[model samples]
Structure formats: structure tokens, C-alpha cells
Target: MSTYVVTGCAGFIGSNLVDRLLAVGHNVIGIDDFSTGQRRFLESSLKSERFRLVELDLLDIDALQRAIKGGEFVLHLAANADVRFGTLHPRRDLEQNTIATYNVLEAMRANGINQIGFSSTGSVYGEAKVIPTPEDAPFPIQTSLYGASKCAGEGLISAYCEGFGFRACVFRFVSILGERYTHGHVFDFYRSLRANPNELPVLGNGKQRKSYLYVQDCIDAILLAMEKAPEKFNVYNLGVDSYCEVNDSIGWICEALKVSPRLAYSGGDRGWIGDNPFIFLDTARIRALGWTPKLTIKEGVLKTVEFLQANEWVFGARD
Candidate 1:
């Protein structure tokens, strides 16, 4: 079992990865500043002797290098995970999401780490012209600063992988929904209904459709990609192929909550400045590697809603 350094280890996806790695008895060193991730989320893993948590910001190069020093591979997932927040505070988004990634790469290089797996997003393909956006989708004009930052990070990874001969995998993830997911559309809908028990805030006329991947599937693909990583850079699109619209997801949440909520819209058909109306990822390349998502959009959303309902305190504290 190789020692791994996982950035954003306290976040939803990172925490899940930690659980899996620990289950398999792999030694893991995790680093997170808890800006978006939570310390409480990793309490279970912290109890394990194989796990170590470094409470340091990724922007601190020395700290990151120290955390990653003896690790054989790095899983880079630290980021400003909110697109709306990116619109409101562009500088913070770029600095944290983009610049932090650059720093992580530099730290890995300094530590002589040549293997990395980056958690990228489908947002980089902003409003794709084709359905099931491929890995080589021209990386269309990204709208939000968040998307641009992710694209920039991907570019940096590619350059590093090629120039330094490191093994790297870039996963363009869709909307991830599952246990511990506290910030996606599913979580947002559940919170809104719980607060009012009657009114649900609907963004964009609710016509938006996109694939949603369960957290387990996200973890599975990451591990599989690492197992199948190439000597050079490799990028893959990951998501459940089927698309579910925003309004439809709201309906699912209401049914699960057993609440009849009035729908409220922000109007204008466009949800937000950087929102993509519809997107589907082509997982053929990753699927060709024999990795398949086990959860559909509905299954993922329903389970996520249940988790959100059961753990109201997690979302409640931030509210």
C-alpha cells in the first residue's frame, strides 16, 4: 500500500476517498484548511493509525511540501467549490482554486512526486455544442472564473505531466451527489424545503439538465484511473450518462421529503451568470477502461436527500 497525499481531504469527495483508502489499509496523509471542507467530517478517519491530517492551507508551499514529502502520489482536490461564490468574489476563486493548484503542483515537483490525480470539473466545457461532451471538447469558452481557473489548472497539470514525465489523470466530474454532499443542487433543495417546509427556490426556469455522479462512483473512477494511469497525462470525463433537469430534481426531493413546496424562481431562464443549461459527459473513454457508474441521477439524488435530511446539523450550522 503506497502512501498517498490527498488535498481537500475533509471535503465531501476527499473524505470519501479517505474512507476507502483506510478501508483497504493504505497509509494516507491529508491536508485541508477547512475553508469549505469540515474537520468534523474526517473524525472517523482520524481515529485510524493509518491516517494523518495536516491542518494547513494548500497555498502555503512549505506546509504542502512537508505534508506531501514522503507520499508516492498526490490527489489534488482543494478548490473554492462554489460557482456562485466565484461570481461574487472572482479574486478569491482564482487565488484559491487556480493559484492553490499551481502551488500544489510545485510542491509535488519539489518533493519529487511524479504521480498526481486532479479533481477537475465539467464546468470547463461550459455550454458544450455536443451532448456527452468528450475529453477533447475544445474546452469551450469557460464562463465563470471558477471554470476558467479549473481549465488553467488542467493546463498546468498537462504541462507538468509532459515536461516532467509524471503519471497524471485529470477527471472532469459532473454534479456529484451522495452522502456528505452538502452543497449541490440536491442539498440546496433539501435545505430550502426544510427551512420553509413549503417554498422551494428554483433557479433558471428549471430547464437545466446535467448528469449527477454518486460520490462512490467518483471515488471508484479515481482509483480506477490511478490504476490505469499512463506514463503521460490522461484526461477522462466522468458522470452518469443520463441527464436530469433541475426542476425534475426538485420534484424528486419533494417526494423524498414528503413535502409539497411552492416553487419560487429567480426568473430570466438563466440560473446564474456561469450556469450551464444542459450538459452530459461522454464516459466512453473511461468506460472503455471498464469503469462504469453504479448510480443513476435519480438514485444518487434520492440517497443524497436522505443523507441531508438525517444530518440536518451539518447544513444547519452554516445556515
Candidate 2:
């Protein structure tokens, strides 16, 4: 019955992690700003007596410190995740991701809390030279502001671990999909097709190779690493073993919906300013701890389509 403080508890991954924590009889305090997170995602957790939801942004350092006072571990997942449009508001990622992470670390230090699990991204690899980028892959120049912000967050966590005697596990994730998924290419494609089933406007050339992990598999890896990995500051690339092209995912989504929309691709290989053409992570490190993804890339894509179909209100609710 360990007490855990989870930031971004109302978001997709945050809410799911809260659910898992409560199911295991742990007391959880969830914090979120509702900027991109939805209240519906936390509906189930809200009813539990052991779960408490705090509607506040991490930028409020004073309130953040108070909220995290008695927690044993912090699961930091709150961030500005809009990579494509991040450049539009450049300061958003810096404030929401990097500075917010610093605030969390400082709060933990003040309260004498020593353990943290951070949600990082594979985007830090930028356009990597390696096909299956490992944990030790050399970091190329960051392509997106979101990635740069996360990298900064990771650095802060590591420094805190070394100087403050804190223990941290940073999980670099691929694009995740499953129930409660609100944004990303799959959601965009589904919404576009629903408006007009005959035609679809594809971003980029639909040839960009990427990897995706089911949301549950992602959560499983996080919990496993937190429990098993015994390092002062650990980093693991959490993803599936295989990769899929954007066109392959589009095909899966269309097949699931029983629609053959005319594909209209926006010219160029990169979908957006910071979109990576290829992102496949080597998950052998996490696998060494007996963690493996249960769903295939195709299965995850189809499941995302089905979840969107059933939960159409998420579109309006989140947007």
C-alpha cells in the first residue's frame, strides 16, 4: 500500500496509470491542469476513496510542493506533448515540461522524497543514425522543441539523483496508442474520415516509419523498471520490437472502419517541422527485466481506431 504521487493524472497515460495504482491497493494523489487532459479519463479513479485528484498546474511551485508533501514516489508524466505545433508557442514546452520537471524535483527534495519515475520520449534521438536506436545511441541535434524540453527534464532528474541522493527511472517512450488516446495521427485520420469517408488528407508521404506501443504495455514497462532496475539514475527505451510505416497504419485503420478513403498526401517525407521519418527503439534493456509488449503495432493501431469509434465524445471533450 505504497503512496504514489502521479502528475498528469487526468491525461491519457496518467489516468491509466492511476487506475493501475488504485487496482493494486495503492493510495494515489493525481495532479493535472486539464489543459490537454480530460476529466472523463479520471472518472473511474475519482470514485475511489484512495484516489485524490488535484486540478493544478505544476508551474505553481507553492501549490505543487504542498500537494506532493507526503508521497513516497513521484510518477512525472505531465508535459506539453504537441510536438508538431510546439514551435507555434515555443515557450509552452519549456515552461510546461522542463521547468515543471524542475519544480517537481525541488518539491520532492523539500519533502525528502527520493524516488521518481519520469516519462520521457524517444524524440530526443532526433534523426538518429541507428535503425533501432538503443539507450546508448548518440543524441543527435534535437528536431523538436518538445524533444529538447524532455531532454532538459532528463538532465535535471539525473543531476538531482547524483547531487541530492534521489533515485530516478526515465522511460523514453515511442508513440503510444490504446484506450483513452485523444491525439496523434490515428486520431487525426479517424476524425478526418468521419467528416468525409470518401477522402483522407494524409500528412507527409505516409511512408514515415515509426514504432508504437500499447498504452498498457507502456505502463507495464514503467512499473517493471521502477521495481526491478536498481540504478541510481536509470533510463530505458520502452517500445515494441517491430516498426510500421504510416501507410501501413492507415491501411489498418481503414480496414477497421470498412472505408476506402482516397488518400491525399501532403507532399514531403516529414509530416511536420519536427516529425521524425523513422523512430524504432531497441527495447532489449526493458526486455531483459522480463517486460515485453503484448500487442503488435498493427493490433495497437486497430485498437486505437476502435477506441476512437466507441468514444467519439473524447474528440469534442479533449479539443
Candidate of highest TM-score: 2
Question: Considering every candidate listed, which one attains the maximal lDDT?
Answer: 2
What TM-score does structure 2 among the candidates reach? Answer: 0.99
- What are the lDDT scores of the predictions, listed in order? 0.87, 0.94
Q: Against the hidden reference, what TM-scores do the models get?
A: 0.97, 0.99
The superposed Cα distance between candidate 1 and the true structure at residue 82, in angstroms, equals 0.8
What residue pairs clash in candidate 1, if any at all?
A: none
Write model 1 residue lDDT over 1-319, tens digit each, in one string.
8999999999999999999999998999999988778777898999999999899987788887888889998999888888876777888877887889889889989999989999999999988998878988776787888889999999898888888877889999998999888787877777777679878888878888778899999999999989985548999898987997788888888898889988888876568888888879999988888898898889999989878877888886556
lDDT of 2 by residue, 1-319 (tens): 8899999998889999999999999999999999989999988999999998888989999999999878999999999999999989999999999999999999999999999999999999999999799999999999999999999999999999999999999999999999999989999999998899999998899999999999999999999898998899999999999999999999999999999999999979989999999999998999999997999999999888888989999878856
Number of backbone-clashing residue pairs for each candidate, in the order shown: 0, 0
